[model samples]
Target: MKLGELLAIIRRDELDDESQPYLWSNAALIEYAEDAENEACRRASLLRDATTPAICRITLVAGTSEYDLDPRVIRLRRVRLTGNSTPLVPVTTAQLDEEHPGWEDETGEPSCYLTDWETGEIRVVPTPTAVGTLELQVVRLPLVALNDMEDTPEIHARFHRDLRHWIVKRAFSVLDSERQDKDRAKDAESRFALAFGDPLSARTEEWNARNLPSTHRDGSE
Candidate 1:
């Protein structure tokens, strides 16, 4: 759904005419809806991994084993060394140090990788014998935002109901309507579960039962 339409609905149904220009303005609703969309993106893993680089080069410094990854990357799904189809073995810093005490002394195609998530850096043991590409699969944050009436959400239209419910819940909370906030929050949770499927299912059949896909009323899905 277009962001403007979603914000308009929140303003009409949740904020209403009485609170229109005072308690919540058009800009405020747009901001709140964006926040809700971000939260939903994370919760449902809706943000695609398409932004991940096809290859991150590993610099072959004579003495250094570490290289920077793209800052936009949220987390690495898997990484491969040059010419290898399978993902490289992953190792923790502690394990790398323990197993390869003289990692600097070695030089070869990286067989194992260690990552510093906080720094967005990767340490390859044996430093590359030659500079090579680090083929990777990664998750990234969504770039879309709403700044005006024409702006649209990056979220799939299938999840629009959940997004609307989420905005309604946030609207109630911001307005200090405790009872309505709790009620709308519950409604939002239900829509979210329906959109993303139940997380607690162990059996395939049971999981499929709760994983039914939602259809859009606009016939877009």
Candidate 2:
């Protein structure tokens, strides 16, 4: 169903008392907003305290049918600080060659090797010679409440539209950041080229021409 309808159902179920015109008074709304903001901060702080570093994953899940009910499906992901450094020990290229003998030479760089001592799984590790210490950040939606929004048709519709917009925008932001990061790791001059393939290359001419302008407009110049 549409998000608006879902939100409306939540509202109606939660707040069925028509007598109260302002189901959520202005003070209550303000308090709710504050509570949400505070909850986000509090959860973030708790993560910081629990985790060794100041980085932790945040997941948001919005209930569609019942707030008390388990989510129809749970989505999970992680988040980490931008500058947090992780360890990268060195391994011999010759050792990697001995392990993955079938791996053809794709990029002529010296292959790095890694061996899972326990599993005996040997694999060639991509070497970030220039870029030392990399960290993978995960972003996720944890929990969301659609309570009482579905009851009122107008409020439900608005909530759905707004919620979808919020989700899309947030998701896009995370993807955009990740793309930029991968481009940076590759030491590429342009994120657009890194993300959509080389624009100047003859093979990718069609895709380049189609997306280059939009990519530039998207601030990937």
Best by TM-score: 1
- For model 2 the local lDDT of residue 181 reads 39
lDDT of each: 0.60, 0.28
* lDDT of candidate model 1 versus the reference: 0.60
TM-score of 2: 0.19
lDDT of 1 by residue, 15-38 (tens): 564452456566766776777776
Q: Name the 10 consecutive residues with the lowest summed lDDT in model 1.
A: 212-221
Assess candidate 1 and give its TM-score to the true structure: 0.67
Each prediction's TM-score against the native?
A: 0.67, 0.19
Candidate 1, residue 143: how far the Cα is off, in Å: 2.7
**Model 2 agreement with the true structure over 97-206: per-residue lDDT tens digits:** 77656444333222232333223222324422232221212121123342342222122222223222222222223344431233232332233232223323333432
Off by over 4 Å in 1: 17-22, 50-64, 175-221
